[model samples]
Target chain A: MTQTPVTDSAVNPQVAAAPVAVDVPMMRLHVKILRFNPETDKKAHWVTYDMEAQPGDRMVDVLNEIKWYKETGLAFRRSCQHGICGSDAMLINGRNRLACKTLVRDVAKDGGTVTVEPIRGLKVEKDLLVDMEPFFDAYRAIMPYFIHPTPFPAKEQYQSEANAEKMAHSSNCILCACCTTSCPIFWVNGSYIGPAALVQAHRFIFDTRDEAKQQRLGVVNQNTGVWRCRTAYNCTEACPRGIPITQLIEEVKREVMFGQS
Target chain B: MYKGREGQWAFLLHRISGLAILVYLLLHVFSIGSMIFGEPFYMKIHNTYDFVLFRLGLVAVVAAVVYHAFNGLRIILMDFTSIGVSVQRQAWYGVLGITALATLYALIKLIPRIAGGY
Candidate 1:
């Protein structure tokens, strides 16, 4: 990657000249990955793979090296190879993060070890692959799509900037389940609908054009809904999209309590 | 990874302090309620609590109660206020600061009493 050095003689005549294109030095990183094969192995185990990685190499690149060069049997879920797909969310060093987005330098401690595991609170199917059905089920339960039950007008339903701004961050969620899987509450109670579902509900609940605010709010207002969130803020921290999930859930809680819709 | 910051610790400490208060409450009721069994029983119960370990436990309980009470208010503020969620970490430090001050105050008042054995 081409990077302008912080100190360059071009900018400051007194300073020594620095290279315009500075290549990131490669460092050896020991990746300890949680491995599980439901058919062969009754339990999960850790397998460490030592490899050289550039500072800016993504976690997915590290996993790809293990799967392609070291061990051909290594398995993982990755599609877009970018953060947008949200298919590669995993537990990186104890936090839920998109594997494709997290750089090796940021996660690796002084060129030491980086632990990779399937996101918790879900069934592991194989190495680095967790069953995402439960995560998606919660997402589906929130009625994620826009719903306007009544007949629509002839023209487009234009939304105001203020109204759109309210649901802007919530809509950015890619259903990654990073927030939901990282939640301690969801780790034990799988039916709590989790933060992903709540964010989805928030997106619809706050939309000015959607008529299903009460319907959507009612779904999230159950005993296992917004009230279950203990304001741990783990969801807020675990969100790969940087969505303020805990605040959204709290807003939903207030709506449920006061019937604000 | 599990490197949770101030918010995580705040939640964990809040839960722990709340449970500590509950345990202390149960012990308090049982010990104080020993008065029903007459003077000898009440005296025995009170004397046992005077032990150094038990005295230390009482101080810890005071700290717990203070932390729990202040953190509970922080949680309530986070639930209702517009700026509370944004500035939650600062509010948590405030909660911890108040708890520390209250615990220090308790220590100042109780140390002399414990030392004098009165």
Candidate 2:
């Protein structure tokens, strides 16, 4: 191999012009939040914050980043980081979704702003946390606990696989109240016992082990009970666990209307 | 009863009011259906509704109608489009609150008429 001598200007050239630095785009997120102070403000207001966000970041992550790193007064509820706990359900942009499950990139897809607010209908405790008592009240009113018929046998109470499959969907309720909150019927009347309770009631109504079907049906037969559901299908649409809430409610309505098993 | 967060309650109330309206409508239809039996039977049934219990039922039905109709419009907006769900709580509160005030005014005006002031 032969080596050739190179010129200084050709070899150096100001160290190749400082290696022409290439700029990589950093992730940026703009969150416009609805803020209200029950103690100080007479009305709610919109507040926007700029955030540094990554592609995998969930809405809950952005909210925490804003609270811990930017604003200390931000308020919202989140129990389990995973979607199972159902504690972080909120309005992201405009739809009802669990904050922990929503990706910030998807929410800001249009290069537009992202908006966060408390779930609708309940009283706001602060910025993002709203009172959740009414939801549970409706849940409890349906007598959700299982009421077994006759004494338990020495062996495990058996259900055919088909029967078990029949009740499987309604049994998946996490008591998240997401379905109940999304229901339009529940939105108009607080006393309607809502879909969650109706779904719970249906769980036991179809159970061969449960003997209190009539009693349970009677509770829901009131002026503000299963009869209220219009089958809007919003509950089914909003359910994170994919529970068929409207189907169960319709079944319960049938049982109540017909007074059958 | 669980307080069920704010949005949950609004949703619950919407369902309740909707059901109330439905029940009231059924009763109204049944009551009016008696007209097919001729005016005498209809008049008899209509006259029975002059009692205080019936009047109270009317008031409830009216309130339910007002709430359901107003809240229903709100729900229609929320469900049919993308704009209303974010402010759903506010829209619900706004509709029901205004409807309640209007219902109160209507009741105040109606009571005098029903009480034989006319």
Candidate 3:
């Protein structure tokens, strides 16, 4: 390697100097995103962007690149960007994953076309964004908050450590629509309470302190509730928190079927 | 939901296979009802099943049944068992691989019987 001495002009580029030799090859990726804007467009369409990215760059960073440097019209949601907020969940390379959690190199195909789209079963709000009202409606139907007949104790309510551990996986949910949106049953039958809501139901139903176990079981006893789950395991696979969503849904289904008291 | 190709394919195969089995069961019971009429009527109805086209249909149905059964086991493992939940993608591949080989073996055996050896 030949050394070109750094001139005073190179140190302070206002003076200008000879261009430095370059060797690193630029890596590029094509992010194919589904775009829709009800205000201006009749239907959704595919839009591709050519982006230069590093191996470690996250999918949200790729969208940020398009918004910040390439195209300003790109739209998606992000909060903590650390998978905690679960706002950036989307379909990347044919699976639901957090945009901030998915790395650029991981999703890039061997031939190099990475498809990005809003999670299914929801109305598209815009590019890479989906209306989350339907998902939240199912979640809210599950009565995610704790419910008990008796009033609170003078101090903290007595919940055993063993009992808390039973609801550990269900408690990890951050309201990400990945599991629910990845469900085929939910896509065909929008009325079906999907896996995410079922998991939420399980969260409360299994809590020893909860007095509404019977109520939660009744909520999921219908045809379009936990019975709709065919155990495809797509929800289990799509969950970012590694929660056993299918297992939780199955527990609810068993409770519904056998009338567990 | 259908975005993931492998999972979507498995789910579709499961549903289609299930419907196929149910419809076949109805047809099977109805056709066997010919036995109540007499021996000739029963043999006449059963003879069509010996044809090449029906043999091919048999192979397809068997494939469907095998795929559905194995995939159901895979899903049961995923849903009921604690450990298999995490490696579901790999379990999916296992279901597919086993179904393919088992279906092939079934076809190979059925092709021989189609020629009237059995």
What tens-digit string does per-residue lDDT give for candidate 1 at B1-118? 3667788788888888888889889988998898999989999888887778787676788889889888888889888875889989999999899989988888888897667554
Tens digit of lDDT per residue, candidate 3, span B1-118?
3555466677888899999999988879978887889989898878878777777787788888888898888787765655656666788798888888978888898877766632
- The DockQ for candidate 3, computed on C-alphas, is 0.33
What is the DockQ score, from 0 to 1, of model 1?
0.40
Q: What is the C-alpha lDDT of each candidate?
A: 0.84, 0.73, 0.81
Instruction: List TM-score (chain A only) for every prediction.
Output: 0.89, 0.85, 0.87
Number of the predicted model whose TM-score against the real structure is largest = 1
lDDT of 2 by residue, B43-118 (tens): 8888877887767666666777777777778666654444554565577678778877877877787786568632
**Best model per lDDT:** 1
A22, model 2: CA deviation in Å? 16
Error of 1 at B68 (Å): 1.1
Best-to-worst ranking by lDDT: 1, 3, 2
Identify the leading candidate in terms of DockQ.
1
- How far out, in Å, is residue A171 in model 1? 0.5
